[model samples]
Target: MSTAQLQYQSQSVAKPYFIAAIGLFVGQVLFGLIMGLQYVWGDFLFPEIPFNVARMVHTNLLIVWLLFGFMGAAYYLVPEEAERELHSPKLALALFWIFLTAGVLTIIGYLAVPYATLAKITGNDILPTMGREFLEQPTITKIGIVIVALGFLYNIGLTVLSGRKTVINVVLLTGLVGLAVMFLFSFYNPENLVLDKYFWWWVVHLWVEGVWELILGAILAFVLIKTTGVDREVIDKWLYVIIAAALITGIIGTGHHYYWIGTPSYWQWLGGIFSALEPIPFFMMTIFAFNMVFKRRKQHPNKATVLWAMGTGVMAFLGAGVWGFMHTLAPVNYYTHGTQITAAHGHMAFYGAYAMIVLTIISYAMPKLRGIGTAMNDRAQIVEMWSFWLMTVAMVFITLFLTAAGVLQVWLQRYQPNPMPFMAAQDQVAIFYWFRELSGVVFTLGLLLYILSFFIKGKQPAAQPTAA
Candidate 1:
C-alpha cells in the first residue's frame, strides 16, 4: 500500500487518544441501550445495573470520550496549525494513559460499588462533590481530572503560543481553556439547591452551548479549508461571526436554565429572549458548510470526511437549533421541563454538534495517521459513510420517539385538569420507550460498523521497479 508522509512526527501521539475515544464511545452507547431497555422493561437490568447506575455510566462515558476526542483533535491539529512539533509529545502520551486509567477506574467504581458506599470510601464526605447528575465522579477522581486537564492545557498552550498564531488555533485554545475553567464549578457544590443547580449549568450549559461551539466552529473551519479548498480568510470571517453569535447568546442563555430554579422572575424574560436567539450561530454554521462545499475549488478524494462535515452542520442546526427552540422559552419549557422533550434535544444536540465534530476530525486525520494516504480506500469510505447514515438516522428516530412521549407526558400529567400519577403517565408512553429502544439497537449496529471500517483493508499498490 502507498503511504503518505506525515507533516509532523509528534502528531502520532494522537493515535492512542483517538483509539481510546472510540472505545469509550462504544461503552457509552452500550450503556445507553441498557438504559433504554430499563425504561420500558422496568426490571431489565434488575439488581445488577439499575437505571440510575446505567444513566450515570452513560452520561459519564459520553463526557469522558468526548474529552478524549477533543484532546486528540488538539494534539493532531495544534502542531500543524502552529507550524511546529508538539511542545511535549511525551507529556501528551503520559496524560492519555493517566486519563484513560482514571476514567476506567471511575466507571468501575460506579458499577462495582453502590453509590453511597463508593462516596464514603472515596472521601466524598470530606469534599462532598459526589451524587450530582453528570458530576458523579468521586472527588478524588475529579481532582485527578483537574490535574490531567492542567497538564494538557499547559502542553497545548505552550505549543500554540510558540508557533504561528492562526485564528483556528487561537479559537480552539480559548475554548479548551474555558472548558477547564468551567469544570471547576463541579467542585463548588453548595448547600443551596438553587445555587448548586445554577453553577451546574456553568459546566453543562456553558460547555455545550458556549465554549464548545468555538471548538466546533474552529474544527469545521479547518476541515472546510482543507477539503473545500476554500481560502482561510473566507473561513475565518465565518468563524468569527459564528463564535460571536454563539457567545453572545449562549452566556445569556444560561438564564433559560434559571427560570424555575428559584431564580428571579426577570429571568423569564431574559432567558426567553436570549435563548430564542441561540439558534442563529448554528443556522449560520449550516449555511457556511453548504456555501463552502458549493464553492469548492477542488474535488477532495475523501468523500467520507466531506459528508461528515456537512452532516455535522445540518444535524447540529436541526438538533440544537430547531429542537432547542421548540422548548427553550420559559413558558414552553415550564411544560416540558425534565420530560422526554429535554431528552430529545440532548440526544441529537450532543451527537450532531460534539460527537460528529469529533468523528469528523478522526475521519479526516485517521488515514493520515495510519500512513494510508489522504483518505481511506473506497471500500472503507463506503462502509464509513454507511455507518454515518445509520447512526444519524437512528438518532433522529430516537429523538422523535422521545418527543412523542414527552408530548403525551406533558398532556397527561401537567396540562390535563385531572392529572395522572407519574408512573401512570409513564405507562401511557411505554410504546414510545419501546420504539426508542429499537432505534438505540440500530445505533449500536452503526457504531459497530464504524469500528469495523477501521479494520477493513484497502487494495494494495503494486511495487515500483527496483533500482539497477
Candidate 2:
C-alpha cells in the first residue's frame, strides 16, 4: 500500500466512543441474562433485583448500547463518508465518558431503591413520582440520554453540514435528527393523564420503527455493496425501498398502542392498517440483501459480512414488523396487549433490524481500521456472518414459542370471566416465563461466541511489489 493510501489504523484518533460502546454492550448482555432468568424462576432473582427493575434494565440497556455503538460508528463513518476527519474528536471523547458515567450511575440508581430513596429525599413516598418503580428509571437515565444525543447530533450535524453529503450521509443525518427530537419527549412526565402512553410511544415507536430503521437499512446496504462487489445501483434501490416503507408504515403505527388507551376506536383501524404493511420493507430488505449478494459477480467468501446483512434483513421481517402486526388489530390486541407476544417482537426487531445493522457497520469498519484487505479477512468474516444468523435465528425461535404461549395465556385470562382462575391466570404464566428464561440463555451463548471471534486474529495481507 502507498504511504498516501493506508487507511488509518484506529476507529479514530480518540477511541472513547468505542470504549463506551464496549461498556454498553457488556451491560446489555449481562442484564439481559438476568432478565431471562427471572422468567424461568420468578422468585429466583428479585429484591437483589426486582422484576420491574430487571425489566427496565433490560429495556434501557438495549437503547443505550445501540446508542453507544452508533456513536462509535459515527466517529468512524462520518469521517470516511465525508472524506474528512471528524470535526472534533475531543468533543466526541468527552461525550463518550459523560454518557458512560451517566449510563452506569442511572442503572445504579434504578437498582438501589426507587421510592424509599426518593421518598427519604423528598420526605414522602406517597408523592406521584414515588409510585411506579419504572418511573424512577428515566428520572436520571433520561439526563444521560439527552447529553449523549446532543454530543452525537452536534458532531454529525457539523460533519454533514460542512461536507458534501451523499445519499448514505443524508439518511444517517435524518435518523440522528429524529433521535434528538425524540429524546426531548422522553422527559415528559405524564403524571395524571392516560395519554402518556401515546406520548411515550412517540419516542420509542418513531425512533426505532421510523427513523432509526432508515439509518439501519441504509448503513447495511452501504456496507454490503462495498464489500460484495455488487452494482451500486441495485443496493441503493434496496435502501430506498426499505426507508420509504418504514416511514409510511411506522409513524401511524403508534396507534397500535392507542387502542386500549383513552385515544379512540378509530386508531385501531389506523394502527392496524399501517402496521400490517410495516413489515413489508423489512421483508423486502431481507430478500433484497440476499438476492443482491447471491447474484454477485464474484463471491468474496467472507461469511460474516454476508451473513450480517442477510440476517439483519430477515430478522427485521420476522421480529420487528411481522410479529408486531400479528396481534396489532384492535380486536386481537385488546386481549394480547400486555402479554408476552409484545416481547417476542421487541427481541427480534431490535436485535435483527437495529442490532445487526450496527454490527454490520462494525464488521466493515474493523477490517478497514486494521489495514487489512477484504481478500484475507474473508474467512474470519464468514465465522461472524454465521454467528449473526445463528444468534438471531435462535432469538426468533424463542420469540415465536413465547408468542404462542402468550396467546394461550391471553385466552384463558381474557375469555374466562373468572379472571383469577389461573395462577395469574395459569400459575402466574409460569411456563412461558421459564421458556423465556431458557431462550435467553441460548441468546447469551450466541452473544458470547460472537464477542469471542474479535480476539481470534485474521490473516495478514501478503506483501505486494513496491510501485515502480
Best by lDDT: 1
Kindly give the stretch of ten consecutive residues in candidate 2 with the minimal lDDT sum: 1-10
Clashes of each: 0, 9
> CA lDDT, every prediction?
0.93, 0.70
Per-model TM-score versus the true fold: 0.97, 0.88
Where model 1 places Cα greater than 4 Å from the true spot, the runs are 1-4, 460-468
lDDT of 2 by residue, 146-231 (tens): 76788778887888778767677778788878878875666564664675666777777788887888678767867776656777
Worst 10 residues of 1 by lDDT: 459-468
Q: For candidate 2, report its TM-score.
A: 0.88
RMSD (CA, Å), candidate 2 to true, equals: 4.1
lDDT at position 15, candidate 1: 87
Instruction: Rate residue 419 of model 1 by lDDT.
Output: 94
The total number of steric clashes, by the backbone 3 Å criterion, in model 1 comes to: 0
